[model samples]
Target: MRVVLTTWGSRGDVEPLAGLAVALRGLGAETVVCAPGDDDFVELLARAGVAHMPLGPTVRSVVAGPKPPGAAAAFKLAPELVAARFETLARAAEDGCDAILATGLMPAGARDVADKLGVRYVLACFHLLGLPSQFSAPGRRPGTPSPEGETDNRKLWQQDAERVNALYGPALNEHRAAIGLPPVDNVRDYVFTGSPWLAADPVLLPSEGMTDLDVVQTGAWILPDDRPLPDGLEAFLDAGAPPVYVGFGSMAAYAPKDIAGVAIEAARKHGRRVVLASGWAGLSAIDDGGDCFVVGEVNQQALFRRVAAVVHHGGAGTTTTSARAGVAQVVVPQIADQPSWAARTAELGIGVAHEGSTPTVDSLSAALATALDPQMRARAEAVATTIRPDGAAVAARMLLDGASAAA
Candidate 1:
């Protein structure tokens, strides 16, 4: 079977899909990763030996570029961006492909393209974003009870659906009309069609009340394996005790240097060694001194295994990696699905979630103190034992099975 797996966003988004592509190829399925034309992602597809086709703007460009002032402003602008990018997605999916499996970031036009092509369309995601749930909502404060009741939750979901329609409906309808496809009133329903695959561990995040959506809780789809670490990093690890890993994945947009300095100071205050990743924000630009090693991008799986604990921006992929590594986590969420994952982390007793979106030295120090606690370490290790190791393989089988059934 020939499958086109489409995804966009940062390494956190692309890595999981790349892992899936590798797994699909291993199972004798011909897979192509339809993503942004970024060098890193293109090289990743090449190394994995999966076919690649360019689709959207590179995540690096977006992360490195200027962002809107507030979350509301960013949210308001998201639909226009999605609409603008739909043509590329349509072109990628309209080709001769057996099926199209798209991440949540893929515009709703992907579903229309798959329908026009008369092929299967599947929605896959790492976070619980598109799936409707009364018990939880994306960006909700962690550990807070559902005060508004199911009616209120449903209303909120409907409001979200309406917002999506209001934002993207015009441009989406224009594209639909051009393609001779009928316009959709509910964008969420159109985008989240088919048996959606949730690439998160059921052990870590169960699917108790999510029966309403045709969602599959495939365990966290981690990258296949680790790449070799740099010689300097290897020496740094050997020179001292396991240092705490501090890096904010792709969310270094605002003030990376200040954040890095804070992390370094906090680690110093605790008398702990630290390995700080530069990530997209260029955190490694900060000078390295005693007990601190600043480096460029490295294999997260390998680094997490050797770290005493992880302090990060709480992306879904990072959270899962820390959990699988059996290391305590100190989540300092910046935006989006981060707060939700942070809440889940604290609720599971695997780590501590800082109270706010932004982190200060004091807050990070406190969270790190909790993370380094003996009890927290033990709980994290226990959680690690429950994460399924064959998540990518399982997801691969599911996609292949769906294709075969459709055939």
Candidate 2:
């Protein structure tokens, strides 16, 4: 069997699919990963030994250089951008593919491609955003209370649905019409097709009233192993007590230096050592010395284990990494589903979610203090105990089972 797995966005998006591809290959399925044509991403696929199919714009171009303030402004071009991405998936799926598994960021036309090719399609979500729940909104900010009434929750869900349709409906319908499919009225419903695979642990996000959707909680699909830490980072970790990790992943591209400085200052105020992840945000430019190490991208799993606490943008991948490593977290969410993950981290009692989009020194210091508390550390360790280590294997088996059943 040949499986084509597609995803978009930063390392968070690409890493999970790469892990799944490796697992599927082990299960006797020839796997291909279709993602942006970025050199780093292509190199990642090459290193993972998974077949690669380049598609869409490079993530750096999309995320690195930008002139947007809020998440809403950043996504102004979503319709056209998503349409172009779907066209790429459509073209890629035209090949002899047996199944199409896509991440949450994949365009709605991914399902259309599977239908057009007569193959099994599975939608995999790293977070709980895609699954509709009356208990709470999908991507609400951390610490925001769930609506008391189910009616209010449904209304919030409907508004999100409308917002998605408004952003991608025209282009989506155009592609559908071009491909001889009926127009979709609800983009959310269209995107959440087939047996929905949730790439998170059920213990972390229990499915209580999500019976309307065929949701499968497959745990967290972590990368196979850690890349070697830089010599400087190793030396820093060896020099003193575990340092706090501070990085915003792809969220703080515009002001990485400023963000890094703020984080370093906050940690210094609390007399804590810090490791700053440059990631796509370009934090490597900051040249802070003495107890503060500004380094380029390294494996989250490895670094989180060496760190006493993690202060980050609350990406789903980073959240899971911190949890599984038994480190406390301080989430400073900026955009998209980050706020939701931040909320979840706080709700799990493993972290503190700093309020506001940008973190002030005071707020960050306070959150960092909370994350380093003994009780929070214990809770984080307890949460780590419940996470399945073989999420990739379980996801591969689930996909195979779904394909067999469809056949």
Off by over 4 Å in 2: 69-76, 79-86, 137-151, 210-212, 253-257, 284-288
Error of 2 at 262 (Å): 1.8
Give the TM-score of each candidate. Answer: 0.90, 0.88
Per-residue lDDT for 1-407 in model 1, tens only? 88888877777788888889888888988887777777877877777777777765566665676652444544544554565446655565554678888884636667777777788888888877557777655333222234455456677667667766765677777877887889889876788874677888887677656635878878877666658989989998999888988888777565334788888878877888999887777776346476888877577788888888998888888999899999999888777778778889999999888898667788789888999988999999999998898889999898889888987
Per-residue error at 283 for model 1, in Å? 1.1
Tell me, by lDDT, which candidate is best.
2
True lDDT of residue 342, candidate 2: 87
What C-alpha lDDT values do all the predictions have? 0.77, 0.78
| Residue pairs clashing, model 1 | none
Give per-residue CA lDDT, model 2, range 187-239, as digits (tens). 87888874688887676666546635778788888767758988988999999
